[model samples]
Target: MIDINSWPLYVQLAFGLGPFVIGFSGGGILVFTTLRHYDRIVSSFPNSRGVQNVLRIFANYGFHPRSMQVAAIAGIVLFPRMCIRRGELEPEEVRNFPPEIKRLMVIFTTLLGVGLAWVALAVVLLKLSGGN
Candidate 1:
């Protein structure tokens, strides 16, 4: 068997932590964007009891706001697109999404992007910082 220890430190770090970092960061972005989108829709339809109830249901699932946001997003991403495509949400509901939610989505996406970028940076830093 080849000796992994003989490989460069940067390579080792990248091989070791890259998958976890990328998976976590990408998932985070997807989750944050989904939650923020749903939040905006719920906020716009303040009179809609169903929307309000859905939002509350989402909130009860976790301690961190991020966790709720992520779970909402994962549902959107993983569920059948056809289900949402059917006129479940009104046009006004889509149009009335809050500006803050969009801004937060951008922020969350940026943070995840930065996190993915860091995977490489971390490998280089670890190598320079001296592991092999």
Candidate 2:
């Protein structure tokens, strides 16, 4: 272990907060993009349970912007296969997906993975240090 306890206070603070910062920033951008592009995306994933449920929830919420954003991010990121894979997502739709949406998906997934990994590392560091 790298002995995170021995690190400077500022450095420790940075490590503690970095994942949250990335999660919030990336989440905000992803939500906004999803909000802006929901129409373009919804049609493509008609059979995806995650997408359908989220959209239903988003609709039942009276089309609230924040709800829609949360729905889109959760729908797309959590069940990526529902939107990307051949059996889960329609082949034609996947093939015809817009470039911008693809880029957004990549960015969203990467940000989520990075944020989770960062938090996992922090936990592992602490565990290895015997909660010191």
lDDT of each: 0.54, 0.68
Once fitted onto the true fold, the runs of candidate 2 whose alpha carbons sit more than 4 angstroms away are 46-59, 62-88
**Tens-place lDDT digits, model 1, residues 82-110:** 43466443445434556565555455555
lDDT of 2 at 45: 66
Pairs that collide in candidate 1 are: none
Clashing pairs in 2: none
- Give lDDT: candidate 2, residue 121: 92
lDDT value, residue 118 of candidate 2: 96
lDDT of 2 at 51: 57
Error of 2 at 17 (Å): 1.1
**Clash totals in order:** 0, 0
**Highest lDDT among the candidates is held by which one?**
2
The sequence of per-residue lDDT tens digits that candidate 2 reaches over residues 8-101 is 9999999999998887767766776666776777776666555566666656534465445544654465456645653444555555667777
